[model samples]
Target chain A: MTNQHQEPLSAMLDDELTNNELTQALDSIKDNQQSVQTFGRYALIGDVLRKEQELVSDDSFANSIQAAIADIELPMVDQLETENVASIAKHPKWYQRASQKVVQLSEHKLLKGSAQFAIAASVALVAVVGVSNMNPGQDKITSPVLNPVPLVQGLSPVSLSSDSFKEKPTANQVTQSRINALMADHNQQLRATDDKEELEKEDKKIEQ
Target chain B: MRILFLLITCFVYSTSAAATGTATATASTKVVAPESEQLQSKEQQVQSEPQPQSEAQPQQATTPNGEKINAAYWLKKLQEALTKSNFEAGIVTLKGEKTESYQWTHGFKVNDDGTEVEIERVSPLIGNGITAIRKNQTLSFFESNKEPYSISGVSIRNFIPAIFYKDFGDLVDSYQFVLVSKSQIAGRSAQLIRVESVTKEAYNFWVWIDVISGLPLRMAYIDEQGEVVEQVLMTHLSYLTEPNEEINKLFEIQLPQVANTAIAMNQQTNNWQLEYTPNGFELLKSDRHHVSINREVADYYLFSDGLVEYSVYVQRPIESFNSPLVLKDGGTSFVMVHADGFDVTVVGMLPTETAFKIAKSVKSK
Candidate 1:
């Protein structure tokens, strides 16, 4: 079977075959691993050419298509040949290099001008925002003077005490205890006055 | 960031310090009243005296006919005399803590419409010397300073009794009446009757009745501590007559020019009503009048028993520098309150408590 498939595939490869014979050879190679690898190389070359056509039309589309093609698993020889062609295409011949350098210099000049414009725009935006934040609603606006100390710091202690007092009866108990002490003192004074009066009455009775 | 934090801390410290300082100040101040003891002594003197020895002996006062002089008989006689007497008196009211005096000559006339009209001439005893004359449907203030300010509402007769008769029977009901020793009042020997309220909160009253005419000569109100709160002495009373030349002259005095503006304002905005008052206290006449100074409208309702006249004033709150509640000039007290939608001011020689209650009860719609 392998020998029979090779005769037709070689014929098809030499272009000495009909379309039917070539389709048959291609079908037979689908099940044969070594023939399938050779067929894959031919398909890759076609794919590269189709991709190159799409790339020349739209640059973004071309970059995406190229990235997709680069991700494919090509045979070792094809991969080596593609890389060599890509390097040659990047480095060009001496005359082409000179023309490419000229084009690159012009692009560099345009890019530099755009970059300067972008930088200036960004600087202007920052300055506007900074000035607005610094001085809002001019004429009637008054600048806020920053205090030296945090306002909340002095309030924290009293707030803590008030919160604690609300949670318990300690403050009320203290007030009630003070009231009890004063009442007790008043009672003592009244009792002492009564005792002194009684003693004075007893002395007057004895003298009588 | 450091400055911001410092500012916040300083603000907190100052606020807390202020709060603590207020608390400390409130705590540290000790009120000392050097004259309190002296006032108490004076109050004791007024209360403890005139304690009738007969209170201990209840059976001694029974007549030979065996009819006990009961509370009902005394109250009935007092009410009858009050209803019948053609009593009139010139009154002076002193507002509490105020230096100004308001003198008004008040008289009551029973109108043909079965209502009573009380005429009051409010004359300033001191500066500007303006007299505000009020008659039924006619109000004129005689003032050298401005135009004779005038506006008309209800008459003074409908206004006075509404103020004087709040809980009219309350004094008779709350107190135990005792016919005490005789006293001289208004140059006549009078029967002194002591009416003490059963409750400690009640103020006692001493009413002197004329021995021959049985008319009330004077009435004295004593506070809870038996301090004399006020005294009303009825003298120089004359029966009502047709409008005389002298009466016309008295009513013709105009209010001061400054007061004309106030009277006009007062005439524009006062609505007052009284629901129920005792019998014999008839609304003689009512009038709307303008007050010059504050430009307020006043409704004066006058009521009388052919004798004693009372006036109730419904107007805007009179702006006063001193006590707004008590306007006492001369011997009378004018109790004023801002209530409902209007300022209620009732001035008379009646007890201050009665005046206050009446002023407070005035409902404005």
Candidate 2:
């Protein structure tokens, strides 16, 4: 009922009380019915408080507070870097540092690209050899593998254009453009397939 | 080999979403209107029939013998029955992924302003007791969580009696009501009514009212596909003589010092029109809410006919937004759909199909 007993009682209810305080509160509750009822009320209040705190907090209390501060700090930091980068880019020296960072990020991708090319070349060599070894009746099986020759030929011209954009475009703008293009191309492919299926269905119905 | 690997990856990704209840396997199922020629013929037949008002009015308002019953006569009778009744019941609400169950007893008391304060003792299935005491212009939620939070400028006075009876006169401007059919609920005969939106943007609701007692037994919201999205039912009812003092005292108790901080930085606002709501559904009131931290402009729209009440929330967008689930229990499915910079979440005990339909119909302005 009083603040002295209630402080430890409330903390004990929240499981935040030190061992000594918890023992004292428990002893007090056992001795007096009023303290027992008060403790029950305190426990209920603590449970509700914990639930509400859980609802509002995105992560752990410490993590969420840190995250909120980081969020506030991040934009200011980015803005400072942008202004510095702009001024440095206008000068000849700082451009080198920026270019170096960009190169480091793309280094693994460049290595992966070369490895893919090597794999594709080996597959093509095997396909050509297999086609030569096959009997006359198996020509139909090799015909589909030969179709990728045209697609591989088409990639060279687009990669050349992409290389130019990669050199000059800002990272954010490049990312946004890439996302837009990928979404647009996917939508186009879906439309084409839908149209093809509709036409095929109509033709099948006509035959029936 | 690469194609096989890609196919396996795609299968895994698709199945994972289906397992979590986040994505539906049948989402891509196209709704094809059964050959437009048939629909056009049906439309012509519908247009040729007598006006809905002329056909529906006589059958609904009148008894089996066909005598006109004025709206005022039914409304008064409903008010009297609700005021006189002493009721205690257990209610449960399940909205996508959340369920809240509570037992409550309802009683009326006259305030200083002469308006009645319908006091409800809400003992939650989990956590402390909640006393919701509402009089004209004031709505207070006294929870064990903290100090009592009070909101003024209330339009609706009572939660139960207002929603129990169809008092549509106050809500005529906001909704259009149609008596759908007669159905049985909780072993009693009831009238089913459909409340649809007059405005294109609002959601619609269907409610079942007990015929003899004029009490609401069940309520459902219909989705765009004409499916019930969510439903809440009031099942067992009994009358209690002694007020549950333990529950009442829970409301009177003030919040402890440690829990003085805010649960949410700002009150969330829900803005949408309601179409085809029952006769009793009224826009009881509106209030401006201010918060200490992350303060933003917001409004709360409270609606009740005489019994059932729901709060419509509207607020400014929060960065890195997460949808709030008030409660989740049972097999009820709750869903939050985000599109065009607006997030609409539907929570109720309705079927998943119904919840999905309502979620899809919410269009961001």
User: Can you list each candidate's DockQ?
Assistant: 0.01, 0.01
In order, what fnat does every candidate score? 0.00, 0.00
Where does candidate 2 stray beyond 4 Å?
A: A1-208, B1-84, B108-118, B134-139, B149-167, B239-365
- Backbone collision tally, model 2: 43
C-alpha-based local distance difference test score of model 2: 0.40
Model 2 over residues B54-108: C-alpha lDDT tens digits?
Answer: 2234334343532223333333434543444334566665433345566655544
lDDT of 1 by residue, A67-186 (tens): 433332323123222322223222334224333332332232223232232233222222222222222234233322112122344432221123223433332332223223322322
Worst 10 contiguous positions by lDDT, candidate 1 chain B: B5-14
lDDT tens string, model 1, B1-365?
Answer: 32221111001111111122122111111111112233432333233233323131322332333322543344344443333322233333222223334444444445578675545555666778556666643545567867675544222221122212122353443456676765555444456777665543234666775433344556666656566655555543332212233444554554333322321212333355665333344564455654333334457665443323345667554333122355333224455566755566665434456557666767765
C-alpha RMSD by candidate, in order? 33.1, 32.5
